[model samples]
Target: MNHDGLRFGNLDYMQIAWSEVTPGEVHASWSGHLTACGESVIKAKPVYDSRVRDITCAECGATAVFDLGTAREKAKAITEKYEATGSLSRADAVSLRETALQTIAPQAFKARRAGDSWNAISSNYLMSTGAATETDGTSILVGRVGLAVIEGLEVSEYQGGY
Candidate 1:
């Protein structure tokens, strides 16, 4: 059926969410999918409904958005920082992961084997950041040169490259 001159027959929702890093701009995300979902941009069509402004995803009738644009830019800055200083704060790593997910880049990566190579070794990013501890182990969220993260990585193995 048609609602307010917008058709819902296609069932493509641009559901998204974002935060105001600054005013007059927004960093948006389409949950993981969007109507015109592209690796670079997101598009939200107005349904003209006061109750539900944008039908990004028809989740039995629910929706939202995210800031992939701002996110990618932030990720780039973080990557650049890591490259220049070979160091990233825990916050930077988290930002990278967030943008990487939005940009469709490799979100899960390990430090390159301690050598001349910049290539990151693939590691398990499925683990929670909180799982690791200072005494028992380090948090995979440890800000390192390689966005270092691990699953059950013992404190002893924490020489810390990736």
Candidate 2:
């Protein structure tokens, strides 16, 4: 697939998707830094480390996650739990997103630092990173970015394919 190139700076995390059949014409994104909490998320190395971080702050120091498949599933489960109980609240939602964010940071970090690589089909491609090398809120790896077509905030077509 061909992409027009996307960039995120000062973005702890981002979720991207297409809005219609027009490919990239209709795009949408949600920020990790501003989602449920104001904290910036970290992308770290190794799945184990990422999982640890997402499960607890002592391990990850982040409040949200991105790109980790397992973490995403867990986040969904958390949301389901909230809905099932009919006790959904702002705090509950925040807590679920926070847990998922923290849990996936390490995996995202590892992906960016290790096995993950960017492939641009166009000649004018310019992939860049605005993250810091240190572990602090001042910096963070870009979180999970997926391509999907959504309608009314509900996923209609997911192009990320995992």
Candidate 3:
């Protein structure tokens, strides 16, 4: 009998919460599903305003346009470790996750195991020193790394370089 379609009666879930790091940066998270949903649809909250100054027309106060390059860069890396017996384990995934969630933004970060993979849903960026307006002030915004992530995945018993 094929037991592949049967529901194993367990679901993997993880979540990160909202917190204020600085005036310009706020951290928040939502529940993530692995077994059922391959990826979580997380609405990206406002990240850093990568602008130094706002340009307006002095003659009539009309809106001006400026070249704003890419808000964030794509950063990704993968690492794998093995046990003494040369078997893939959850620890490797944990280490990879930690390494992946390094910067403030994770546009392309992913870690996979035998049956599960952790991927960054959206762009998470950081704020650098830039210009500001008199009214808006210097309210910068950054992105979220990940929520309360878990590293419990069932992988094969074979170790390989990540």
Candidate 4:
């Protein structure tokens, strides 16, 4: 009856506190009957494991996976381009970022309704452009942006409020 839900990108997974003792027998808090093995499984402890990463959606039967490394790489590339050009305005940067996101996740960026636009659900952050001193007193300029990829898309502008 009571469970937790997790979202990654456009995918969602439910943490149902239940256990299966047989092929057709499942013990959970929602069901009053126990498993065929007579195991009284109630709200069990939720296990967070990478092996069970993907979950099928009950409504549409779609699977979604979250890859942070890929997102970071994309963000880094955008920031590096801005740093190289040195003439990118705020509007241009936002447009570039949104375009990149749309290219990355086309299915997730698909419009759900008529006259809908795909926009970022996450916060837009500015990239850092400064030199860093290493331990050996060497200066290095890295184009880094502590920005996460947009997880969800909506029919609205992501960077409208200035």
Best by lDDT: 4
| Descending-TM-score candidate ranking | 1, 4, 2, 3
| Model 2 deviation from native, Cα RMSD in Å | 18.6
Deviating ranges (above 4 Å) for candidate 3: 1-20, 29-93, 101-162
Query: TM-score: which is higher, 3 or 4?
Result: 4
Ranking 1 against 4 by TM-score, winner: 1
Candidate 3 per-residue lDDT, tens place, 46-111, comes to: 224211121111100000010001111111111222333344345654443444333211221121
Per-residue lDDT for 114 in model 4? 23
Residue 17, candidate 3: how far off, in angstroms? 9.9
lDDT by residue (34-151, candidate 1, tens digit) is: 2222222233223331122222222212112122333334445445655466566557656655533432222321121223222322232222233323333123323221232211
Give one clash count per candidate, in the order shown. 18, 12, 6, 0
Give the TM-score comparing model 4 with the true structure, all chains together: 0.26
- Model 4 residue 158 lDDT? 24
lDDT of 2 by residue, 1-112 (tens): 1011221121224332222223222122333222122233332233222222223221121212222333344445545555577656657655545543453343333443
* Cα error, candidate 4, residue 34 (Å): 32
lDDT of 4: 0.31
lDDT of the structure predicted as candidate 1: 0.29
Cα RMSD to the true fold for all candidates:
16.9, 18.6, 20.9, 16.0
Model 4 agreement with the true structure over 20-107: per-residue lDDT tens digits? 4433322222222331123455543233321112211211111123233355355556556665677565575555555444343323
